[model samples]
Target: MSADRSSGGGVSRRQLFGVLGAGAAGAVVGAAGGAGVALAATGGGTTDASGAAASVYPYFGAHQAGIVTPAQDRLHFAAFDVADALDREGLIGLLTEWTDAAARLSQGLEVAEGGAVGGSDYSPPTDTGEALGLPASGLTITFGFGPGLFTDESGADRFGLSARRPAMLEPLPRFQGDALVPEMSGGDLCIQACADDPQVAVHAIRNLSRIAFGRASLRWSQLGFGRTSSTSTTQATPRNLFGFKDGTANVKAEETAIVDDHVWVHASDEPAWLAGGSYLVARRIRMIIENWDRVQLGEQEMLVGRSKGEGAPLSGGTEFTEPDFDKTGATDAPLIDADAHVRLAHPTSNGGARMLRRGYNFVDGNDSLGRLDAGLFFLSFQRSPQQFIDVQTSLARDGLNEYLKHVGSAIFAVPGGVAEGEFVGQALFA
Candidate 1:
C-alpha cells in the first residue's frame, strides 16, 4: 500500500533514460560476476528462492510480459474497438504512446513524466492516482489484435493492411453450448492487465484507457478475482467455482520444449510479423450454480472424471497422476466416462494439442432470478488457433456442458514483445 520511491521520486521522461542506462550497466556488471545483480537497475525488490514477497517480470523482452508469466491473483481485461477516424498514422501513434505508458506502469512507475499530482492543477491528471503508492505487485500488461482490426464487418480492409492479417486470427466458431451475447463477443483490440493487488490492475487499465481516448473506445470489460489456473510448476493448482481442481494438465512454464512447440508461433506460421507471437482464445463460461449445486456428489464426480475432494482421477491416483482412460469399473464400463470433461479435453485424445491456460473466477452480483451471475473468464494461449478449435469442438459432448454456458468469446493474435526502442506490433506496421 506504500509507494516505493527507492530509486528516486517524481521521475521525468528525461530521467527514465538515465535510469535505463544505469540498468544496462548493472546488467553488464552482473554478467561479469557482480555481487547479487538485480533484474533491472530500477532496483525493484528481489525475493528469496521461495519467490514470496517480491516477484517482478521485466516489461521489455522477447515475448510480452503476461503470457507465460505466472498468473496473478486479480485481473482487469478490457477490449476496445478502434475509432474509424484513426488512420494508420494516428493508430500507430496511439500504440507507441500506449507502449511507453505500459512500460512505466509495469515497472511500478507513473504513466507520465509528472505523474498524478505533479501535473498542472488546471488540467486533468495524466496518471490516475489510485495506485499512486503501490509496488508493482508483479503487474503485467499484455496486448492483442482482434480480427476486426484488420477488416470491418462488411469485409472492407479498413486498415489497408488486411493482407497482413494472420491466417489464424479469425472469429471463433460457435460451440454446441454457446449462448454468446453480441456485446461481449468481439473486439478490435484487447489489453489484459493482471497483478496481485486489484487496485494495481485496475489502475493500469484506467491509465491506458485514458491514453487511448481518441483512438479507441472500450467495447466491454471484465474484472476477475481468484485465479483458477497455475502457469508455472512453482505455483499450486487453484480450484474453480465448481469446486473441482482446474487446469490440472495445463502447459507449465517450466516445460520449455512443450512451450516452444505448442505456444510460440514460428517464422513459417504464415504472418511473418507474428513469428514469436501466440494466439489467445478467451471464453466467458457461466456455470449454472443452482443446477450444479443440486447435482449428486457421485454424479458431479462422473461429470468431471475426477474426485471432488482430492481432484484425483476416478480410476485412482494423485492429483497429478495421468488419467487412465482404459480402466474399467465393476460394471465393466470405462471408469472415466467418455463424455467426462477431463476425458474429452485431454491432450492424448486431442492430437497432443495443448494451451497455456491463465483463467480467473468472476462474479458480477446477481441475475434477474437472483442467482449469482458468475463464471470463469477462461483465457488460453497457443501457437495456433486451430489447436483451440479442435479441442473445443471435441468438447461438444462433454457431460459438464449441461451445467455450463459459453456466454462470451473472442480471439486475438498477440504479437511478440517490444524491444527497447520499438513499440508493440511495430514489425507488423513496418
Candidate 2:
C-alpha cells in the first residue's frame, strides 16, 4: 500500500476513509462486492480492523495487476501501434510515463500535480476532470507487448526485440469459423484498464492515449460492462451475453497451485524476462443473439450442456459439479452432447489445458443490419499460447459456435510486474 508521491500528492487519509465507508455501505446494500470489497475490506484499503472506505492496489508488484486481481465491473481495453519514428528509448519513456500515471490512478489520484484545472488555462489540463471526485474503485491497469512490437507482418524486427521474443509470443493462428476483421486483430501494445466505474476505466485509457499521442496511436478499443467471469472464489459466477453462467471452472486467485501450473510461465519455458509472466489472448466474439433467442429452450440447454436456470450440468448436479461427460440419457446418447460448449471447452476434453478467463459482456449499439453488435470481450491469461489454441481447437466443433462469430483477435506477452523503480516490460528492452 505504498503511495506514489512523486506526482500528484498522495491520497489523503480522509479520502481513503471516505471511499471505504461508501464501499462498505454499498456492499451491505448489495450494490457492490468482488473487486470493490477486495479493495475496501482487505489491506489494500485504508480502513483499520473495523473497516472504513479506502481501497487501492499497489501499482508495482511481482505480477501485473488486473489478471489475478478480482475482476472489476467495467473494462476499457485498447491496443496501440507504436509510431514508426520512435526508437527504443522513446518507447521506454512512454512505458515509464504510463506506469507513473497508472500508479496515481489506482490510488484515486489525478495524473499529475495541479490535476485538471490545477494547470494554467493557457495550457492543456494535466488530468481529465471527469473522475475528479470519484474513489479509486479498485482500478487496475495492465500492460502487454504484442508480437507486432517485436516484428512486423513483413518479419522485419521493429525494436531490436526479435531475438528476445518468446516462442509463445507469435500471432495466433486463424481458427476454424473465425470471421476476424483485419483492423481489429493486432497491435504492438495493449493496455487493459478495469474499474468498478465505467467512467473511471474510460478516463484511465483516455489519458494514457493522450500521453501516447506522438509515440503510439490507438489501433482499436473496446468498452465492456458486467464481467462475465469471476477470478476469485469469493465472487459469484457471472453470465455472458447468452444469459448462462460462464467460467465456472475458471482458475481462481485462491488456487495457487492451479494458477502457477496453468497460468504463469516458468523460467525454462522461454525468454528469461517472462519467467513470472503469462500470455494473454483477446478475442471479440460477436454473439448472434437474435438467432440464439429463436432456438427452443431445451435445445439451448443441450447446446450449452447445462441447465439454463441453475447452470448445472445436464447429468444432474449443482453449478460447480464435476461434469460427467460419460453420463447417458434415455436414448443412450451422451447426456451432455459431444459438441456442447461446456463439454468441448472443458479441460478434460482438452488434455487438461486451462486458461484464466477474465472476460466481460459488451453491447456496441447496432450493426449495419440494425441488429445489436454485442458479444463477450474474451480475455484470458495462460502459461502458454498453445494452451488456448488447444482448447479453442476443441471448441471449433462445438454447437455453440453456430451462435457466435470471432470478429477480432490478438495475443500479447504480459511481462512480470515491475519493481518500485522499474517500468512494465522493462526486461524486454534490457
Candidate 3:
C-alpha cells in the first residue's frame, strides 16, 4: 500500500512503468513504522532461490507466464463479459490498463501508483489493500480471448475482430455426458490468476475485476486449491479430489520439443497473431463423491487404471513407468481395461494429442442433499482446440465418467505474451 510515484490521483501509462521499475527497489516498511522488511520478503525486488523474494515471477515475456511457469498451488479463474456499449478503442484501453496492472502485481507491487493509503483522502483507494504485506508468491496473471470477444452469439462482429479470430477459436462442441451449466460456460474474455498463497491469487482477481468496473463485468469465477497436476519435473505429481494421481504423463516444461510440438501454436498455423500462444480448455468436472466413496479400493483403482497409492499403471514399474496397454493378465484380459480412464485418454487412443494440464482440486461445500460439492477444475493448454477435442472424444465411454459430471466448460485463445512496453494481445489489435 505504499506510494511509488507522485502523490497524484491517477497514473498515466508512461508513469506506470516508472513506478514498476523503481517500486521493486524500495524497502517495504511496515505501516506502523516498525522495522523495514527485506526487499526479498516484501517486493522491493526479487532474488535467487536462496532468498524469500525468489517467488516473484516476471510478468512480461515472449510467452505468457502462467502456461509453463510451474503451476502454482492456488488459482482464481474468472470469465468476463465485455460491455456491449464499448467500442474497439475502449476495449484497447482496457487491455492496456490490464497489462500495466498485471506487470506491477506480478512483481509484488500495488496495482496503481498511490496504492491503498497514498491516494487522496476523499477518493477511494487505488488498491484494495488486502495483500499489503504479502510477497509475490510466484504470482502469474494470464489473459485469453473467448469466441464471443470477436463475434457475438448472434454471429454479429462486435469489434471488427471476427475477421481476425482464429479458425480454432470457436465454442467447444457438446460432448456426451456433459451436464454443463449455461451461466458458467462462456465469456468474452478470461483471466487465470495463480499464486502459492490463495490470498495473493484472490487479490489479483479482485483488483482486476475492480479495474474492469465499467468496460467489462465478471460473468463467473472459480476458486481452486491443491493443484492436481505438475507442469515441471521438479515438482511431484499432485492428486485430484478422487485421490488418484492426475496428469502423470502430462507434458513437462523441460520437454521443450513436446511443448513446441503440442503446446504452443506455430507460425505455420492460421491467425499468425497467436503463433507463440496456445489454446486453453477448461472443464469443471464435479465428482460424485458420495458414490465414489462407497466403491471398493480395488474397484477405484480399476476405474483409474493405476494403483491408488503409487499411481503406477497396472502394467507399470513405477509412477513414471509407461503403461503397457497391450499387457494382459492371467484371465486373458488386458491389465488396463479398454474403457479405463487412463487407457481411453492416452495419446495412443487420441492420435498423439497431448495436453499440458494444470488442474486443481476444489470443494465448494456440501449440497442440499448433503453431498460434497467437490471436483477437479480441469485446465489444459494445447497447440489447438482439436487436440483437446480428439482426446475428450476418445473418452466418451471412460469408466471414470460414471463417477464424474462435466458441470462447466469453456475454451479461449490465449495470445502470446506481453513484450516490454506493449499491452497483451497487441499483435491482434495492431
Per candidate, the number of residue pairs that clash is: 0, 5, 1
Worst window of 10 by summed lDDT in candidate 1: 24-33
**Best-fitting candidate, scored by TM-score:** 2
Ranking 2 against 3 by TM-score, winner: 2
- Collision pairs in model 2: 19-53, 20-53, 20-54, 21-53, 45-54
lDDT of 3: 0.81
Q: Give the CA lDDT, 0 to 100, for residue 152 in model 1.
A: 85
Displacement of residue 392 (Cα, Å) in model 3 is 0.5
lDDT per residue for candidate 2 within 29-112, as digits (tens), equals: 011235433432122434233221234677777788888887878889988888777787777778888888888898889987
Local accuracy of candidate 1 as per-residue lDDT tens digits, 1-430:
1112221123355544533332210000000001122233212334446342144667888788787777778888988888777788777777787888899998889988778899899766778899888877778899999999899898988767799998778898889999998777788999999877788888998888777765677777888887888776756778888999888889877687888899998898789999888998888888898999999999999999999989999999999999999999999999999999999999988999899998888888788999988888899999999999989999999999898999989999999978887888988887
- Candidate 2 accuracy as lDDT: 0.81
Q: Give stretches of model 3 more than 4 Å off.
A: 1-54
- Candidate numbers, best TM-score first, in rank order: 2, 3, 1
CA RMSD, predictions in order: 9.7, 8.1, 8.5
Please give the lDDT score at residue 244 for candidate 1: 90
Worst 10 residues of 3 by lDDT: 25-34
